[model samples]
Target: MTTAREVLDRCDALAACSDAPERLDRAHLTPALARAHGLVAGWMAEAGLRTWRDQAGNLCGRTEGREPGLPALLLGSHLDTVPDAGRYDGMLGVLLGIAVAQRLRDEVPTWPCALEVVGFTDEEGARFGTALMGSRALAGTWDDAWWDLRDASGTTVAQAARDFGLDPGLVGTAARRPQDLVAYLEAHIEQGPLLEAADRSLGVVTTIAGARRFLVEVVGEARHAGGTPYPRRRDALVGAAEAIVLVERTVRGSDAIATVGRIEVEPGAVNVIPGRAVFTVDLRAATDDARDAMRDTLLAGIAQVCAARGLGMRVTDLYEAPATPCADRLRDALRAGVVATGDAAPLDVWSRAGHDGMAVSAVTDVGMLFVRCHDGISHHPAEAVREVDVAAALDAFTAAVRTVGATAGSGATVRSGATVGSGA
Candidate 1:
């Protein structure tokens, strides 16, 4: 069986496969990502899984069950990451999937459910300006327009895929039919402070938060700073400053989380009055209704602010993704696994972050298990996980798969609960 220590060590090795020698910057479909895939495919093969890379550039490993034709339990997470990423964000989940497969390889031949693990090619959208590209393609939701999206280097996704030896025209071949899967399960880092604050090693994800993002622009006249009086000047920067504050004030006491992570000002000079200010608003909530309502309220309030300040404002909707909830049976299996590990009541969390599971849910039911990371820091170099917690997570993850396999045979339907070995 693959130990958690080995997995962490391998992560350190893969950390070297970056576009920049000084940082972990493995973007999708790049030469650096190809190196990463090579290393992971070897590990998958060693786990006794038949390995292959999909048309969309996702790496997959598969094995049969007691007999051929069993619905497969797909396990995995994205292999790609944000620039300067922490090794464990998406990387840890994919490695854990491999670890679980290695532990169960000898036992799966007698079980009814087949096993497959995937290391998704893109989840961070750091390359092609489209998130969940791999999972969406696998889920059969690929948007043809995404092919035109270009990276900072002006490489279109189609060109990048060609460079990576994948046929962009046949990317749809990577899609899987809904009937082909029992369900999709991913074990990922908590990426937040909840689990750490609770002093827990694992948590069950209730739902992935739905989000609406916009690029808001405030327009005002640019004038000489010394010549323009305070009353006569239309200051876009001041309007933006008020708008950012309003975003916080509007969502302050609510469950919704809002952030203005980026902003740009025109005529960015000390002597020139700003002509325009552009910023981003990312709002997320546990439910679609709540998120949409919060969005409506926030946007309307911002409009009022713009009107009162005598500034022209516009909002360009960047993206929107609805909430994806975990299937009941999968949640139960994960809960049983956690309970078996001595936590009778698994803490439930609403993911404030987005995940590939949201896209994968289009084709099959999706579930997630979150393992605690130190200080809940992610998308950075300092992200770390303990070997003990990983060992626990491995046990829980393997047991969870076993629980589902027992009930997901050719003719069997997955029931709410089942016993896996001595884990009840």
Candidate 2:
């Protein structure tokens, strides 16, 4: 069997040869991104697997099993990276799937179900303003409304798809039928420091956190800074600052988190009193109720602050994604995989910062295995994961595939509450 180091070496080689860089400033996929996709396709072909592109531009590679009648086990993750993202973020999952298929072909010989690996496209939402575009298409969630979205250069998604040799009209064909897949698995870098901080090798995600994003606007009269006394002036920026503090207080009071990540003030002359201010509020929680409560609290707090400052406040919800629980059967299998290697530790817990696995889990029984990332920093140039941790994650994922493959069609329903073992 090829060692994890050998697999990672291959991944590193691809990273170097591809146009994908650690930053997004001048990054363009026009030519180099295509080359990277071709490299992955070539690798899949060399592994003796059949490869093809879906309507949404996802690259799929398949390994048939002894019993071809059973629904296949799907392993997938996007190959595209965020602007200035580390090479490992989404690439590891796709390459690891290939590695697992190679291992199965050499050792197991025959299995009950087939194994399919997919490299999803445009998952970062960096250039197109839409995340999970490929997966959503496969889930039959992509709609016509998004077709006209233009990038910084005013190029539409449809136009970009055509430029890349993909037919926009056929994108809907990417959705998989219910009978075609049994379950899905994804191996990814934790993109956080929790695992490393706890000295663990892997993380079996239990649930993906639900998220709510809002835009808050505070309106007040513009006045000269020198002419307006503290009591006489209704400063919109001041009201916005108070609302930000109130949002923090409300979230801290409940089991939720709210962040004021972006803020803007209009009429930028420093000497004049600002007439209006805008800010974004991002809230996340483990459950839908908690998230909703956080939103309500933010709304109330903003209103109260606006009334107190004699300003008008408006809140608009931009987006909301509900929490998605991981598959019970797959969770148990992941636990068993950890125990099988004897390196398993007590399970550590975490909620996703953004949505990816949740999008897949909504449509299928999906599982995720996380490798510890350095300092819990991601979507930046310094994002990293340790080599040993990566190997451990591969081992756990392999065990999971074996467990799921072995019991594909016995009509044996795996309960959601099954436990694997302790965390590292």
Candidate 3:
């Protein structure tokens, strides 16, 4: 079998200058990410796999098995990254799939099913404001509404699709029939410090956290900061401060988490009292019920703070995705794989910040494996993962692949269909 270090090295070489702003900004499949996609496709073809681009621009490489009609096992992760994102985020999964293909190249005959490695486009949503665009299409979840989504330059997703040589009208062809895919698995970095703090080598995610987003706007009368008496001032910033505290309290009261990630004040001048404030609230929990409770608590707290401050407020939901449970069989397979390597560590715990696996889980039996990242920092240029730990994760993943491949139709893929999108 190919080593994890080798796999990682290959991916690094391919994406060495990808999406680098100086080389054609990689965000939103800008020319840079598209070039990276082309490079990956070239590598896949060289590896002796049949490669093609789906209607949604998902680059797929297939390794055929003895049974052409059997459902294929899908391995995927997005290739696009946030602005200046680290290389390992989505590239590792695709490279690992390539390693799997290399392993089977000269092996004996009679494979049970096919292997498909997909490099999904636009998972970061950094530029487009819509995450998992590629996976959503594969899951048959994208609609015309997404066509209107524009980036900072007012470039629509539809326009981007055309710019990259993909047919915008054929986007629906990316969706697969249930019978076409047996299961899906993704390997990614933990993107957090939990695994490193726990001294673990692998993290078999139990549930991808449920998330709810809200845009809060607070309005108040503007006044001159120097001319207006402090008592007479109607400051939106002051009201926003109170709302932030309430948001903290609301999340702290339950087993949920919340953050006011972005905030803006109108007439942002030191000499003027703020007239309005806008902020986004991101809340996450292990279940929909917990998430709903947290949302309600936050809303009530915001209303109370607004009423006390005599400020007008409005709350709008951007989007909400319920919690998704990882497949039990797949989880067990991963555990076994880790144990087989003799470096198996106890399962690490943490909520995922963002991942494409969440979207795939909505439609099929999907599992995730996370390798510990250095200092738990991600979405930055300095993000790093230990090479040795990554190798261990690869071993664990390879074992899981073998187990799933060997036990193709033993009901493992069937028992967990309900858990894919079930919030529990």
Candidate 4:
């Protein structure tokens, strides 16, 4: 059995392999990723799995099942991180998957299906500003246009791939056919306070929220801060502030969430009136329709603010991903796993944060297990998880794998008593 301390230790070790000195920041194709792969690959080999770097830069480890060539059940999560990231968001999932594989290799020598763990390379897209590049390749959703995407240093994706010793043109080799696998399972931090509030160690994810992001620029005439009359001022910052407030108000009553995570003001001085304000809007909901409704409302509200303030507004789509639901069978297996861990009824939570599962679902049925993070904090240095909860999660995940193996061919679907919520 794997101890939670061991897992936590590994997470700390990985956190140390960051490009940033004071914080964790491992982006795609950078030297940091090479170091990460070296360490993780060593661990994978120690777990008795053959390790390899795929064409799309994802690190993979595989071990055979009961039969020599059975289709593999994939257990994975992204290894990349946002700037100043927490220790347990994506790293915990990949490490837990490796731990689970190690347990299966040692104890269940003749498991029904092969087990594979993958640490996806670029799920965060912090470096290139385009998410899921790694999983999208695995899902056969790669687009040629992404090759031209440039980073802050103006390094194109193709150029970065070459620097990382990967052939950008051959990324297609990473694509896995739908028939090649059984299903995909990911265990990740809840990144929310719900599970901690419910007093549960782990929760079964019902759905991943559909998300859409836009970069909105509110442009207005620049005027002297003191000289301009209040009635004649066309303040872009004020217009943006009102639009931001409207975003919160409009989405409050619905099963949706809207956030203005980033904002930039031009002529950023105390004395200068801002001529332009650019901000990012990230909106998510349980369904695409609801998300679209929220988007429409937000845009309309922003338009009203812009018009009243004589500011010109422009929106550029940054990213969009549809909602993904867990397969009924897989959800049953996870619920049973939680039950075996002494939780009579597991909470069914909707994920507000985007995950690689949303991309992997394009190729196969996807399921997720979410363990609570302290105060639901993630993507920050203060993020934390309890050792007891991680230990419980390990027990539950391993049992879930066994349940999946036993029920793989039975085609049984269990209607759950899970408290399914539409909003994240």
| TM-score of each model, in listed order | 0.94, 0.91, 0.91, 0.90
Residue 11 alpha-carbon offset, candidate 1, angstroms = 1.5
Best by TM-score: 1
Off by over 4 Å in 3: 19-25, 104-109, 252-254, 343-345, 348-350, 415-424
lDDT of 1 by residue, 150-192 (tens): 9998989999999999999899899987667778899999999
Predict model 3's lDDT versus the native.
0.78
Report lDDT (CA) for all predictions: 0.88, 0.76, 0.78, 0.87
lDDT value, residue 142 of candidate 2: 81
Candidate 1: count of backbone clashes, pairs at least 3 residues apart or interchain: 0
Question: Which ranges in model 4 have alpha carbons more than 4 Å from their true place?
Answer: 106-112, 223-228, 265-276, 307-314, 412-424
Candidate 1 has its poorest 10 consecutive residues by lDDT at 415-424
C-alpha lDDT of candidate 4 relative to the true structure: 0.87
Distance from true position, residue 392, model 2, in Å?
0.6
**Backbone collision count in every prediction?**
0, 11, 1, 1
Arrange candidates, best lDDT first: 1, 4, 3, 2
RMSD of each: 3.7, 4.1, 3.1, 4.6
Q: 349-379 in candidate 3: lDDT tens per residue?
A: 4355667777777567777888888998877
lDDT of 2 at 16: 63
